[model samples]
Target: MQSELIHDSDFGRYLEDFKEGMVIRHWPGKTITESDNNLFSLLTMNHHPVHLDQHYASEATHGQVLVVGTLVFSLAVGLTVREISGRAIANLNYSEVLHHSPVFIGDTIYAESQILSVRSSRSKPDRGVIKVKTTVTNQKGEKVLSFLREVLIPKKN
Candidate 1:
C-alpha cells in the first residue's frame, strides 16, 4: 500500500494584490525585554554598553538600558513578514532606515506598513517586486523606527 502526502499553505499577497497606499497593521505586538536586548546584543557582537550594561546606561541620557536598535528593527520586520512577504522569493533590499526614538526594555512595539509600489519583474514572469514603507511604534504611539523594504513575491499558482 502507498500513502499519500498533503501540502497546505497560506501565501502572502501577490503583486496584483498590492495597491499603492495599502495599509496593514501587524497584530500581537512584541514587548522588548532585558534578556532580549542582552542576547541580541551579545549574539550579534554589538557590545554597546548602553544595550548591555544597565549601570552604564543608567548614567546616559535615557537612564536605562536601551534595547538594541537592530533587534527592534528585526522584530518589527518579522512581525509583518507573514502578511508582507511569507511567499517571497527573496528580500531585495532595506533602505531609508531611520531611528526616530529609543526603545527600552518592557516597551511593547507595534508595526504597520504601507504598500508603496508593486510592479512586474521584466525578467521574471513568476515573480514581482513589492516595495513597502514600514513604521514601528511603541505602546504610547511614539514612532521608534521606520524603513523601506523591497521583496520579490512569487505569483500564486
Candidate 2:
C-alpha cells in the first residue's frame, strides 16, 4: 500500500510561489507592553536594568524602561514567518540583523518583507532556497529593526 501526502494550504507559500522582489506586508502588528518586556526579559535571563527596573530606567537616557533587543528581534522575525517562512523545511541563516531604533512599551510593531533571491538547492531537488529582507517598523512609521534570512521551502509537485 502507498500513502499519499498532504500539504496544509493555510501554512505558508512554497518555494515555487515566491518571486524575486516580492513584497509582503504582515498584518496585525504587535503592541509592546510593560508585562511583555518584563516577562520576556525574565524568561530569557536578560537581567538588564533598563528593561526591567523602571526606577533605574527613569534615570537612564531613555527616561523609561527600554524593551529588550532580543524581544524586538524575536517579534520582528515572528511577524514575517507566516508570509515568508512558515512552510520552510529549515532556516538556512539569518544575517545583517540591525536594530535601528528603540522599542518601548505601548509601541506597536509592524513588519514587511521583500524577496531578495531564490535558488534551487544543489543537493536537494525537491526544495529551493529563498532569501528575504524583512523590515520592522513602529506605529509611528519609525524603522526599528531589519534583517536578512534564508530558508528552504519545499516545492509542490
Candidate 3:
C-alpha cells in the first residue's frame, strides 16, 4: 500500500521575500514567569543568586529577581523564527547584542525586526544571506534588548 501525503504549509520566508528596510513585527508576546526564569537559569548552568534567590534579589539594586538577559535574547530570537529564520539554512552570525533596560518576571516581551540587507551568495546561487536588526521591548513599550543577526536562506527556484 502507498501512503499519501497531506497538505503542507510553509512557516517562514525565503531569500526572495526579504527586502532592505523592511520591518517585521512579531505577534503574541510572551510573558516571563518566575519558573521560566529559574528553569532557564538552571538549564544554562547559570546559578547567579539574582536570578534564583528571591531574598538576595530583593536586596539588590533592582529590588527584584531580574529575568536573565540571555533568556530575553533567546526569547527575542524565538519570537522571530517564524517570520525571519523559518526557512533559514543556517545562522551565520550574531553581533552587537545590547541590553538596554531591566526585565522582570512579569514582563511581557515583544519583538520586531527590520531587514538591514539582503545579498545573494556569489558562490552558491541557490542561497543568500540576510541581515536584520531585532529590537525587543517590554509590555510598556520600553526597549529591553537589541541585536543583529545574519541568516542564510535558500532562494525559490
Best by TM-score: 3
The residue-by-residue lDDT of candidate 3 on 43-104, one tens digit each, is 99999999999999999999999999999999999988988899999999999999999999
Query: For candidate 2, which ten residues in a row score worst on lDDT?
Result: 1-10
Give the per-residue lDDT of model 2 (tens digit) for 59-157: 999998999988998998887777778899999899999999988889999888888898899998999999989889999999999999999999987
Q: Give per-model TM-scores.
A: 0.91, 0.92, 0.93
Full-model lDDT for every candidate: 0.86, 0.87, 0.91
Writing each residue's lDDT as its tens digit, candidate 1 over 1-157 gives 1211212334466777677778887776899888888899989999989998889999999999999889999998898877789878899999999999999999999888888889889998988899999999999999999999999987765
What ranking of all candidate models by TM-score puts the best one first? 3, 2, 1
What TM-score does prediction 2 earn? Answer: 0.92
Count of residue pairs whose backbone atoms collide, per candidate: 0, 0, 0
The 10 consecutive residues of candidate 3 with the worst lDDT sum are: 1-10
Q: What is the C-alpha RMSD of each candidate to the true structure, in Å?
A: 7.9, 7.0, 7.5
Residue 67 lDDT, candidate 2, scale 0-100: 91
lDDT of 3 at 67: 98
